[model samples]
Target: MTPDEPRSRLADLGVGPGAFTRGRHNAITDVSGVLVGHSTVHTDRLHTGVTAIVPAELGAERRWLPAGLAVGNGYGKLVGATQLQELGAVETPVLLTSTLSVYRVADALLGHMLEQPGYERTTTLNPVVGETNDGFLSDIRSRPLGDAHVSEALTAAAGGRVAEGSVGAGAGTVALGFKGGIGTSSREVPVGDGRYTIGALVQSNFSGTLSIAGVPMPADELVSAPPAETVGNSCMIVVATDAPLDARQLTRCARRAIFALRGVGSDFSQGSGDYAIAFSVGNGMPPADATLSPLLHATLDAVEEALINSILMATTQVHADGNRAHAIPLAAVHSRLAAAGVI
Candidate 1:
């Protein structure tokens, strides 16, 4: 496909819908008041970039939102984890970038937040930044990102269709042996006289056996075998919702998001850093415990599709070091899924 060609998503392949209905954009931005943007650095040697997720409601007022985090594995440099866990809330927009560039991006994010109208007297801020290693396809040690990129992403944030695959923090990422990048999906659930939306965005860069709708891809059918070096990378999952969930409920939702990895065949290896952060933008009393089942189910479905979309929407990438990550063969995948009666 050409650079400008829109990549296909899970639904585009005729996959069946899950229990809940999907949101308009089928992205995290489907959750009202949430915006997403990316700043990509795609040079010959640098394939890394930064992505910003802004809860628009937190604008200049910088109001805190209920949030929770869950970790499947602990092999990453996720900034602001302890503080987020301790406070059970997030006060600034979340950022994602290359592994080594986490601290730099966090600093830039802090600067961006402090400059907001209401933070003039702010003394402390926990800038949540997440990362996955893009070293195989980028010169990661060079740390190519800066404040400009962070500002670009934050300023460009908007609520609409999100660009996925080989962009933003996922630009150089490898996942399930393929060129993994960014992917997103959202679902809407109905409660008592109201409805809520749960959306998931994933930076997929972990090792796994590729699976679609519970059907595993045969080894002989793969266009290319996963490289030995692609075995122990990480994945960052961000879940957003309009549900009036507290930190505890959001944490449960985040755990479900991480669990969705199993559906996509993630091994959750010792060296892999698998993490999920969930936040809510809605303000009101949360639904009862019984009503949360559908939300949790929606989280699982959205995250699973998001992971698959990360692989499907990505384009092949090559690094300055002569290493390469190939995009999954779409035709072969379609045939495999069709033959398995999955589509």
Candidate 2:
């Protein structure tokens, strides 16, 4: 499929009505004031880009948002992770890009924040940047990303439908033996007399047996085994919510997001860097422990759908060296799910 072709999401295929209701857009942007943008850098040999997640309170009236991190494998680079954990907050927009370009992206993000109207006297700032290796489909060692790409993404941030598949940092990613990219989903939960939204966004580039709704893809239908060189890769998950959850609660939400990978069949390989970063933009008193169950359940549902969407929405990509990663065959997948009565 061409990069511009419209892609289908898990919901469009009638995959679920999980424990909670989905937000209007069924995307992370469904969380109030959360915006997402992408800057794609696609060329013959350079198929990488950047994605920026800008929270509402990040600009002139900048206020640190409560945030938490959970590491599943800890084999990839996540800048500002320690500081985020230590202070239980995020002071800048989160950025995602290729592994080699992470440092450059981080520097650019730092610059972007420092230039904000209220930061004229800023001394120290922590910019959170996450990455997943895209070496197999891109010339990763060349480090193609630059400040311009970052600025483009940050400037384009918007709170509506998010563009998925082979765009942004997901441009050259591979997952479950198929073409992989960016994906997102959100859920709405009712607690006390109020309702909250939990959303998830994922950059899937790891290896695994493709599974959908508890049904695994037949071995014969596999898109050939994942290339040996790309076997142990990684996945980055970001969770956002408008729920009044504290840092500790957000950390729990992050862990639940990581566990959602099991439903999609990820093996969590030794070299895979699986991580989940969760942050809350809500205010007022946090919910009681008894009321937290629905939030956790919502986290699991949204994250699983987001992971699946990452694979389903991806288009086939060909590397400069002639190696290719094919998109999963939707027809076959549907048949499998039907045969198993999962649809």
Candidate 3:
């Protein structure tokens, strides 16, 4: 069997870096009160869907999560980012979908928010939506992801182990010429008081050379690989933490996440629109600067693993239009990392 066929994430390889511990689920949902849901539409002609991340109860109208935005490259359409940057908070659930499907998802999310018990008569709510183009593998022009699909995901939101790869907004996405999708991981940072959990989720749809555990994917496998293509040029990162942090600290965590992206070989090309959004469920303000290193370090490591998990958990896919995206070969990747003394 080919390495790409393996069903596993980065931790399954036992080569991930960092000294921090992981949460029970090793997913973003490990952060208290965080929930993730996905609605995938993978058919012969259309392969796209929506993913919703909820940090609080749906009916809490006045309650909002402290959030921050960091743009690795400003080539994205993260709706409500201006407000998030200015106000440092998000009032509605976060949804991600195909590039062309973002608007519909946003509208549907707005409906869901307004319909929530406390939002009655609430004039305007900023819906946070992000996207990557799935045009190459799917008929993105068809805009198959609609309000109903978005509602399904919202309704399905729950906390626990999350489904990854080839699902949600990542259904038809490609990354680094490989089959890329939704991936998640978490890390727990120990402090003098108590350990805090930091979790990360990524919709990886950017292009770059695949690297695992600090080693480049071996070239021999690439030479024998089937043809693959990148449909989108962006990545969306969502980081959640149980630690008491304000929007400013979350923004710093996201900046560290961006640095972690480079560790996985992301080229950050001009066409790429990489963005990271981070939030905390706690109401307390950020900690002292000296004490924030653990959080930043935790974010860096988790983001790296989350990005790696996207390709590792993905399987090669063939689109109806004859375009294809190969999965990053896991066995070859492990072997290469071993040869490089990185594992």
Clashing residue pairs for model 1: none
The worst-scoring run of ten residues by lDDT in candidate 3 lies at: 218-227
* Cα deviation of 298, candidate 1, in Å: 0.4
Which lDDT tens digits does candidate 2 get at residues 1-343?
Answer: 2342456788887787588988999999999999999999777787789999989776767569999999999999999999999999999999999999999999999998888888999999999999999898899999989799999999899998999988999998888878888999999999777899999999998877878898987433655545323533899999999998899999999999999988898878989999899999999898987888989999999999999999889887877788677777777777888898888
Show pairs that collide, candidate 3.
none
lDDT of each: 0.88, 0.88, 0.82
Q: Please report, as a residue range, the 10-residue window in candidate 2 with the lowest summed lDDT.
A: 223-232
RMSD of each: 1.8, 1.8, 2.1
Q: TM-score for each prediction? A: 0.96, 0.96, 0.95
Off by over 4 Å in 3: 1-4, 218-220
Candidate 3 lDDT at 309 equals 86
Can you give the lDDT of residue 96 in candidate 2?
Answer: 91
Q: Show model 2 residue runs off by greater than 4 Å.
A: 1-6, 218-232
- C-alpha lDDT (0 to 100) for residue 175 of candidate 1: 86
When summed lDDT is taken over every stretch of 10 residues in candidate 1, the lowest stretch is 223-232
